[model samples]
Target: MQESKWWKNAVVYQIYPRSFKDSNGDGIGDLQGIIRKLDYLKELGVDAIWLSPVCRSPQDDNGYDISDYRDIDSMFGSLKDMEELIKEAEERNIRIIMDLVLNHSSDEHLWFIEARKSRENPYHDYYVWRDGTEGLPPNDMRACFGGSAWEWVPELSQYYFHQFSVKQPDLNWENPKLRQEIYDMILWWMEKGVGGFRLDVIDQIAKEPDLKITNNGPRLHEYIRELSKETFRKGDLITVGEAWGANTELAKLYSNPDGSEFSMVFQFEHINLDQQPDKEKWDLAPLDFLKLKQVFAKWQRELYRTGWNSLFWNNHDLPRIVSRWGNDKEYREKSAKMLATLLHGMQGTPYIYQGEELGMTNAEFEIEDYRDIETLNVYHERLEKGYQKEDILNSIHAKGRDNARTPMQWDDSPNAGFSEGTPWIRVNGNYREINAKQEMADKGSVFHYYKKLIGLRKTYEVFADGKFELLLEEDKDIFAYTRTSEGEKLLIICNFHEKEVPFLLPEGWSGKEEILIANYNEIAETEKLRPYEARIYRKA
Candidate 1:
């Protein structure tokens, strides 16, 4: 069975290390802080933890810019602390998954340092470098953070390609020697007992003949196959690739049945529903429910037989799903539960981002209070291009990465119990009512609801191996689907709106249905669904 794999039945929790918790009063989260929370995660019912980058870095892009792949940064803790954390997590039966960034490295990395020295340096070919166009950059391609993708170096009389910030130069995967280095580093981590890796922007590793095209380069699958053969295939490791612009066909190739590359891939189509057409991510608009349903249906049906899917709404980079997709102000709890039910009921692995289980809302921080470099850079650029400050701030509120990066709310104490001192970033103001301490104390809160949802995934084999079929495909206000495996079939219905809606059961589906789960205290006794209500039923 495709879903029989260890990770397919596992509910993964993503932890943004810098914002999870702070130990030693540094006001920044650390390895020891994660150790302190292992029991909490275990209690929450997550089987694996995927940590954002924690390797040695200059922190230019919030730890994505790695300088040393072998050691932990002093900001997080020493390598010994990481080892201890891993051991502690294992004791709790939770696997640890490190975020691996193979596409690029910090400009301060030793390899990049040597590569920038001169053409004669052996490491010069470690990164993508080309001669300058009469002092101008080699191409007009824009990096993810904005500005030209190429940076010139006078010492080498050449420009280096950087797909992200200028501080993060793209690595040359064409160099077999560099690939060997990456493989060795991954093997070292696996030897330390890391259960798996979450590859960051993995699809961006291979570019076309020129540096302009963004994702899904020509040799992308070749590089992934080699990496998988050398690293992941050596063990029962779970690897997921973050393919930002990848569609179903490309996703299948990266995560095919042959186990050539990754166990699954994170696709961005559904999440980009609210992004304005012909505009950047900051240009916010309402999500089209029809389009959202179509994207999910397409991925579920296309990837069912050969590949796997990584189901997630909130992550380190995107804004909180409740705020972006649901009503954050009025129906926060209900909408959060609805979103969770819809996600977990799908035939894929579910990922819970930090604070998501507590139904944490987005931070309504003013532009000045935001800490994410991408948010600030985008804001300033848009303002310079004649966008009003208020409009830009509103857009930032709707789509800024800081919405998901705010300090995790543990309690109602100072800094929401995230830090004793001033936090690296501002904590959300509503933590007093939405913190985990409060939610865990209330059995009916979002925390306990998420626990139940996760438990269902482990208890029911159908959730893992069943074939997905979308129901009421044209319904915009409600999302309904069914999963059938063998003689068992489950019907999941979710009200995506804040108003009640009447839903009729599909034809040829008349039978005594057992209520498997629901967001409310009890399943509704009528055909009408409550606002933001969700229910799962199993047919005998």
Candidate 2:
């Protein structure tokens, strides 16, 4: 939108702060450890780093359960370390974006502590609390972790709302004072010279005072748009919202810089591929190829033209895409390279989760090895509900948020060398072969391929901020799109299927298309793609 649209060319690398590296050798990652890796990150060719969450917390949800807005968790070092990191990262021309967990805070947080003291406490209105309705939990709303949204607090003699775990109480944006507090935290972080934030469960915020007590309640954005005006007005502060139900229309409401709060909002439709069928209406639906094409097709076209889509396949919450969707073990290099080509070539800033470039997969662990608070609670609760352990395991296999939270695979050493001693979490079993050191050494490693993708975006502006025109919009096994600006045109052709299939070129798309990069092998001037192969071409 301006002469300095670097974000278009930006490659944002995500660092799970607890597993990134630990300077303290306490078997946990800290801020100083991140500082040590700044040079490596600069070489990694990222425009910025999005650190998950480093604020003060009891860490029930890792650091998402922030206990203090203004202070750094002693586990992550001091606020002074954070300031130093900002300076160092800026010096390396790399910006840092911290996670803004505004939806909730640890129950131990001062505000929550004050609010829970008594129903008449001055801070009581800062969180959502209600007299239980008809001897039941406050509402039928499902917590993302599991169970009802209301948690009975004996101290308050009533239930306070928690859209997540009981330790993390949802903030009441309905309270003007709480909204001001959020704004104050944003201003504080910005004043410290940090680049921006990735707002956690951001859409869960600005709860509608008029929110009907029902599933998919309406009028959430009416409140969010108003909150955007009250806060998030600074320039160059790129904030992205974590919103699962947002569409192009909702994105415009949150990112329409003329007034909205964030630079972009995450659209989780494509990532919900495992849940392709509506559980209530359809099962074994074959993921609806036409619908699949339509999903990403509509997202790319609508969000690109309407506002922006936060394009990503894996995050800290989901299992690694290579393992969950693609053939990381069987196809290995081919699939990892293919996925990288397809993802980064999309219309938004690409986020590469730690160790993903190495083609890392879900850890093979017995059910007992899992430590996610939500997963543990869900298993126990499900057991008490008469569900078979197999059924519970299947759910964990399908919906385990703990899968991606495993420690980063840095080397073949114990704990993946993520830490000197045992890590807070178990390392994936495939760590020896699928570690970062090997990826760096191999010329054909996924790490270098990612570097190539980042290089392509920076060296060629045609890949960024260009118009996206999907070809063969009806293809069930193929995803094809063209990015063009003036005389420059690039075709991103990808085969999502496992078997090799002949691809039909789009009308008026022919005549010596030079393949710039290929996932499987080099593409002839005019030839077909290999299985799981992807090609980027410029028409001659």
Candidate 3:
């Protein structure tokens, strides 16, 4: 029999601490800021919070590069503050999940600092290193952030491998000593009472730079299984890996029923539909509604009873869903609710980004307004290739990471109530109308709609263990599906476009249905769905 998992039915909220709230007026959100807002999250009704990295770092990649695994960064808070945050959250019945960047560490880390001093240092084997060929890098492989993947050391006369920024050196997982160190660090955090971990860039850990392989390496699962046996299996923990290269076949190995690896993974196949194949994310392509529906249906069916899924639309590294897939201007509230219904009605754990529940829209940023490292690198790289500045700006507006990093809009006050002083990043211009304070007061707002959607997941048994079947597989405008369990059925229909679309009830699914939740207040009994309309019906 399959074992039950707490995270299976729980709704997780992802908080990017730097942008969530500022408590000390230092323009950056800190641990105390999150503590002050614990009541707010408790009222939102999330079961867990997945926080991005808050460990000690040089902020080269905005905290992904960890300099110390045992200590919290001074910028965020001390160890006591983190302990207090965890204790306070537990009192509110909410679990805390930390982000673990195991693939690399900051160059300033003591191990890396020692390893770079000399090739014969005791910590030299902690990182990947190679001898230069003809005074050049061992290979022509480029880094993910637009540079050589190997950085030369003048004193050592060798190159250290880095899949991301030069300041972030890739760790050598083949070393059992290094792996044990990582395991011990994870256990230390577990001892601190963390509920789980979100492994960052986990798929690239077993990479072979010499063979030009970056993801899904030969020993990938072997490493993951070993890591699981060493740490997570010791506790009832939830582990979700960020695997951009995963498909249904690989997903089974990562999140199989045997509990060998992770509980689930964050896949990007659906998120990549709008980008050109085998190209950078900035290479744009029109999103096909049919293709999007087909991808979701495939995962929902393939993972049923065999593994699990993680349903989400927005995160710290992507654009807002309302801006990317829905009409962010006129129908922001309606479209946001529609997208929420589509995701929450699925068979998986749903994650809500910090500002997403309030129907946050993308920022209208100019070149000077951008602060993300990836965005600035892409902008300069495209400009050097003769691409028009206007075109690059448009792409950034559509797909930049900064779109999701803007301060959370708590109210209409200056800086969106995120900070008393100047914000590190500019707030979205529509905060006056879309802030959370305004939504919580209005019953029909997106914030309340999200609350209802979350409540439905907790109340319905079919949502956690039901058979999923796509309703309108060939329909271009209406994305519909059904979930059935123990003779109870849920019909969920969503209009993908900004125009009214005809929705026909499947045979034997009409007249006996009760409206569970909807974005529009008055859903007509007629066959037409208004612009960005979404509705869920329950029948026994």
**Which lDDT tens digits does candidate 1 get at residues 229-283?**
8888888878899988788888899888788888999888888789789888887
When sorted by lDDT, best at the front, the candidate numbers are 3, 1, 2
Candidate 3 residue lDDT tens string, 1-540: 133598888999999999999999999999999999999898889999999999999998889999998999998889999999999999999989999999999999999989988888989999999988536899999998778999988788899999999999999998999999999999999999998999999999999999999899999999999999999988888899999999999998999978899999999889989988899889888887899999999999999999899999999999999999999989989999999999999999999999899989888799899999788988998899999999999999999999999999999999989999999988888888889899889999888888988889999989998899998788888999999999798999999889997777889787457999988888788989999999899998
lDDT per model vs. reference: 0.89, 0.76, 0.92
Predicted structure with the largest lDDT when compared to the true one: 3
TM-score winner, 1 or 2: 1
* C-alpha lDDT of residue 211 in model 2: 54
Candidate 3 lDDT at 49 equals 93
- Model 2, CA-based lDDT: 0.76
Task: Specify the poorest-scoring 10-residue window by lDDT in model 3.
Answer: 1-10
Off by over 4 Å in 2: 1-5, 118-120, 131-142, 151-158, 208-231, 257-259, 280-289, 377-399, 524-527
Residues 1-540, model 2: lDDT tens digits: 211345666888898888788787787888899998888788778888899888888888788899998989998899999999999999999999989888888999999889988888889999988875445775577676677777787655688878788888888877878877887777778788878788887777756422533212455566566555555555466668888767778778766645455677878777665553556111112345566667777877776655666667788887777776677667877777787887788777788887787787876566898988767877787789887888677667556766787887888988887888777778777888888788889878888888888888887777766788878877767888888876788888888767877776777667366677777555644456577788788763
Q: Sorted on TM-score, highest at the top, how do the candidates line up?
A: 3, 1, 2
Q: What is the C-alpha RMSD of each candidate to the true structure, in Å?
A: 1.8, 3.2, 1.6
